[model samples]
Structure formats: C-alpha cells, structure tokens
Target: MKHAVTVRNVEARPTAVVAATTTWREFPALWKPMLDEVWACLRAADIHRGCRNVMLYLDDTPRVEVGVELTQPCPLTGNVVSSSLPAGRVAMTVHYGSYAELGAAHDAVIAWCAKENLSRTGVRWEVYGPHDDDPAKVWTEICYQLS
Candidate 1:
C-alpha cells in the first residue's frame, strides 16, 4: 500500500503509562496486560481521559510505554507513571488497515528516511486511532523521531 510519509514537528504530550522492556515477539502478549494495569491505575488515580492508545517504542531491545493520553499532567500512581512524547521532528505516516499490517507503516518511514538520508534517534511510536467495528477501518499513526 502507498504510505504518505511526511516530516513534521510535534509538541510533547503527557501520558499515563506503564513502561516495559520486551521483545517484539513477546510484546503482543505483554502490552495489553500492561495497558490494563495502566487503565486500572488511572481509574484509581483518576487521571485517564483519552481513548487514544499511544505506545511509545524505544530502542532495539524494544522498550515500550503503553498508555492513553492524559487530560492534564498528573503524578505517579503505582505502576502507572507520567510520561511524555518527546518534542522533536519526526518522520510519520498513517497506516489504514489492521494492526497486523502496522509494521508496513514503520517500514515505509525507514525507507523514506533512508531515501532522504535522514537519521533517526531510535525512538518511535504508534498512536492508535479510535475504535471501529471493522478492522479495515482502523488507522494507526506511526512516527520515528529524527536526530
């Protein structure tokens, strides 16, 4: 599929998250439970306010911070802590399909950066769109921070 890759500046946004280090293979199983805890923590802390599921992917070891955006800045609550999407220039694209095909979007960004001779900071993320009844309607915004 064609990916409309673009580079833009994004402002840092605070989140309520649960961070973990796991391989991509293990991520599928781990992420949801971690996010579940984040939701519970948010409910207990009373800070959760957004439906956007933002998963901040960092490093090759595959460290991830999974959570939803917060309505306002908040303090630590058990396992759920405050995190922010770093403010920087990033190569980004929106993936319109199943989450299973999301990697294609990441690959597109990598290829785009290589073609443009751009360097990445080894930080990337997927901001999931609102829920849809059909998987075909799901869209994810993938971004890679530039150095």
Candidate 2:
C-alpha cells in the first residue's frame, strides 16, 4: 500500500527505556516484558509520562529500547536507562493496522527517504498510539532520523 510520508522537525524528548539486543522475530517477546518493566519503574519513581510508547531501533539486529516519554529525566538503574530521542529532521509515516503489518510502513519511509535523496542517521523509532479492539484502528507513527 502507498503511504503518506511527511518531513518535519521534532524536538528532543526525554525517555526511560529498557534496552535489549534481539532479532526481528523475537522483538515482541522481549519488548513486551521490557515495556512492562519501564512502566513499573516510572510508577515506582512517580514520574509523569508526557508522550506515547516509543521503540527505538538502531539496526536490523534490532537493538531495541522500549521506552515511555517522560516529563523530565529521572534516575534509573540496572537494565533500565534514561535517554533522549534526538531532535532533528525526520521522515514520518503512520501505520494503520496490526503490529504484524508495521514493516510496510518502515519500508515506505525508507523508500521515501531514498527517493528524496535524504540520508538517514540509522536511528529509527515507532511511536505507539492508543490501542483498539479492532486491529485496523490501531495507529503507529514510524519515524526515521534524517541527516
């Protein structure tokens, strides 16, 4: 399916993430637990979340950072760490379907970047929106940093 791609500047956002190194096929299994861990930490720390769930991917090996955007950075330890999503130009596209179909949205953004002669910084992430009983109604924003 054709995707509507947009280019915009996004400000840096602070996040507390649980980092993991896993293959694409194992991502969901590993990340679900990590996401739960992150939320638990936030609750324990009494930190207010400012934005949606974000999963930053550094490569195809999929070094994943399961994170929740925070109003401010809070101290974290052990497997969970604090980081910021970089501020800069980005290529964005929304994926409207089940998580299983998200790869198409990623492909669309990468193709769009290539067509536009935009070089990517190899930092990409997905911002998850509200969940719906109907998978078709689910929304996720695929964002790629542009260089």
Candidate 3:
C-alpha cells in the first residue's frame, strides 16, 4: 500500500469510549461486542454520535478503547466512559481498505516518522469510516502522537 504521511497539530476531541484489553490477535473479536454495548448506551441515553468510530491503542501491551465521538460529554453509566483524543503534533495517514489491512498504514506512519527523525509518544488511534462492503471505499485515519 502507498502512503503519504503528514505532520500536523491536532485538536483534542471528546469521545465516549468503552475500554477493553486484548491481544492483537483478539481485536477482531473484541471490537464488535464492545461497540454493541456502546451503541446500546448511546441509545439508552438518547445521545447522537459525533464523528467516526475511534479505536485508541494506549500501549504496547494492547489496551484499547473503542467508541464513537460525541458532541459533548454525557453522564457516565456502565462501562462507557468519557475520554479525549490527545491533541498535539501527530504523524497522520489515511488507510484505504479492510480493517485487516490496517497494519500497513501503521507501518507506513512509523517508517515516515523514522525518516523524519520524529519522536513518538507511543499513542495511536484510528478513526474509522462508515460501514461499507467495498474495501476500497472504506476510509480510516491512522494517527500516532509526535512528541
């Protein structure tokens, strides 16, 4: 996959997330079930979702938070909690295709950072596009914090 990475200052965005811990191999199994709970919480609270679904990876140990952006923070209930996408300089790229193919985008960003001699914050997140059957049309913004 071809990627063009860019460095930009990002603005912090509030999100309603459900945190989960799993290995890389178990991610596919974990996200859908977590997102179901997220949706149910949103529905029960009568909250309209904001932007794309975001999965933020917190560390190499693979702690992840899966949730959608909300216009503003809501009262917390159950496992859904309010969080913010970190702001600051980031190495960013857009990945086009299946979720299974997302690793290439991450690799591309890391390589770009290395080439640019940028320091990493070890924080990464993906903003996913609308559900689609066509892999080519699916869009995901892959971002890694630069520090």
Candidate 4:
C-alpha cells in the first residue's frame, strides 16, 4: 500500500518522551510497555497536554541504533518531563495504518531522503498522535532531520 508523503521543515520542541535505545529486531517487544506507559501519562495530563503523535528519531551512527521516544508520558508517571530536539531541516511523512506497518513507512522516508540528497542527523523519532482505542487506526508521523 502507498500513502501520500509530505516533506516539511519543522522545529524540534521540548517534549516529555520515554526514550529507549535498542536493536531493530528487539524494538517491537520493547516498545509496547514504553508506549503503554506514555499513553497513560498523556491521559493523566489531560487532553491539552496529551500528545497528538509519537516520534521515533533514528540516530545517525554506524551501528544499527534506534531511539523510541514518546511525545507524552504514561498516565502512571505524574511527572511533567520535556526534552528539546535541536531545530533543523527535516523530512516528514505521515503513515496511516497499523503500528506494525510503521517500519515500512520509515524505510520509504529514508529512501526519499537519499533521493533528495538529504542525510540524517540524530535519532529519528516516531511521533504518535491522539489516543486511538484501536492501534490499527492510529496515525503516526516519522521524522528524520537532515544532516
């Protein structure tokens, strides 16, 4: 399946994210608990503070490294935490489908970046949007900053 892609220049704002670094194969299993926690925190923070999307910023390292950062906290964590992502030019794309398909979306974005002669900087973030009861219906945005 193909989805429309958009490239935009975005500023990185400080956000409360539950971050975890792991290999590609281990990401899925590790992300579940962290994402669940992030959701709970967002719910507790109320609608206003709740994140509209989750971001996965891929780090530019030789080794295969991925960082999963939550836009909002899990309801259980009452603390309001925020981190600033350095502002820069980024290639943005929206993926509409099951969370499982997000990887493909990222691959597409990477390919797009290469085609445009753009290099990635720090970790690529998988930004998550509002809470969708069904994960399949959730809309996530994958953004990778240009190097």
lDDT of 2 by residue, 1-147 (tens): 677999999998888899888988898678888988888777777764555798998777888789777766566766789887778999999999889989899999999999999999899988898778999889998889998
Choose 1 or 3, whichever is better by TM-score: 1
Residue by residue across 1-147, what tens digits does model 3's lDDT show? 898899999999888888987898998899888877777888777775554699898987799999887765467678988887889999999998888989999999999899989999899999988878989999999999998
**What residue pairs are clashing in model 1?**
none
**Model 2, global lDDT:** 0.85
Each prediction's total of clashing residue pairs, residues at least 3 apart in sequence or on different chains, is 0, 0, 0, 26
lDDT of 2 at 135: 92
Give the worst 10-residue stretch by lDDT in candidate 1.
42-51
Comparing candidate 2 with candidate 4, which one achieves the higher TM-score? 2
Residue lDDT tens for model 1, 1-52: 8899999999997887899989989988999988888778766766545647
Ranking by TM-score: 1, 3, 2, 4
Model 1: residues with Cα > 4 Å off, grouped in runs: 45-49, 73-76
Which parts of model 3 have CA positions greater than 4 angstroms off?
A: 47-50
Worst 10 residues of 3 by lDDT: 43-52
- Model 2: pairs clashing at backbone N, Cα or C within 3 Å: none
Q: Which stretches of candidate 2 lie over 4 Å from their true place?
A: 46-51, 72-77
